[model samples]
Target: MEVIAIQKSAFDGMKNELKELLEMTEKVTRKYTPIFKAEKWLDNQEVCLMMNITKRTLQTYKDKGLLPYSKLNRKNYYKLTDVQALLEAGQPYNTDGNGFTDQ
Candidate 1:
């Protein structure tokens, strides 16, 4: 049964402060948020299938630094963007219908 009241001017100021705080919070979150979620990732099998190459070829790409990837728990993962870049750069794979790729 508390009848205490805050002044309208005071309440307005508090509301404005809350709004500012929320805006700042949003800005901070947006700035620090990791972009990994927005990006697409592929595994070794998927990359091999997409590029029509073998696993050895994919490993060669990794060894030659033709593609960028992330390794987790002893498994290799690749970014879709990097794979696309490799495809766009040139034909790094064998065009002679071989099962391997160019070193």
Candidate 2:
């Protein structure tokens, strides 16, 4: 068996690696935590961030009732489940009732 010397650089490298591992573990843990999933409703900014959409696009959805929402004190709140279902359902572009693109 050979003796391995522990140096400051090696120790620091190990510490950094451990820290990175811990951070990744925390991220994975947090992903399945109930606190994250407890948010049944989402505001506009959160919806935009999750859907990678601009506020204008979100407004368009709201205008067309594509994304169901409820207003509380004049503020709109969308259901997270509904948003997820909409994504899973793969909604198509709206038509102008005459089979023409609404665009």
Candidate 3:
């Protein structure tokens, strides 16, 4: 019984130490990885191609706040995940019977 108690305490200590080590490793990995490395960036052309729409239509999406974007210098950039989420939700914005819509 006494040996069992000793073994249990030792096991608990090892588990706690292991948890700490894993957490530290995660922190170090995150610290060295570039945040943008995880996100795939899409420019106007790529976004249009991916959505099978025109540049003007892409602008409509931005105007409607359906997609989030960032401007780097003179060019606009968007995240692949954001666009993919909208696609997964069904149709983008309706263009009516025409190929475009008046925003």
> For each candidate, what TM-score against the reference?
0.59, 0.50, 0.60
1-103: candidate 3 lDDT, tens digit per residue: 3544468789999999999999999998887467558788899999888888778788888998999998977999999999898888964666655667744
Off by over 4 Å in 3: 1-33, 96-98
Candidate 1 residues 47-94, lDDT tens each? 988887778878788988889999867998898999999888875767
**Which has the higher TM-score value, candidate number 1 or candidate number 2?**
1
Each candidate's clash count? 0, 0, 0
lDDT (10s digit) by residue, model 2, range 1-103: 9988899999999999999999999998887566446768899998878876667777888898889997867988888998898778864454344534455
Please report how far candidate 2 places residue 99 from its true position, in Å. Answer: 24
Native-structure RMSD, model 2: 10.8
lDDT of 3 at 69: 96
Supply the global lDDT for candidate 1.
0.83
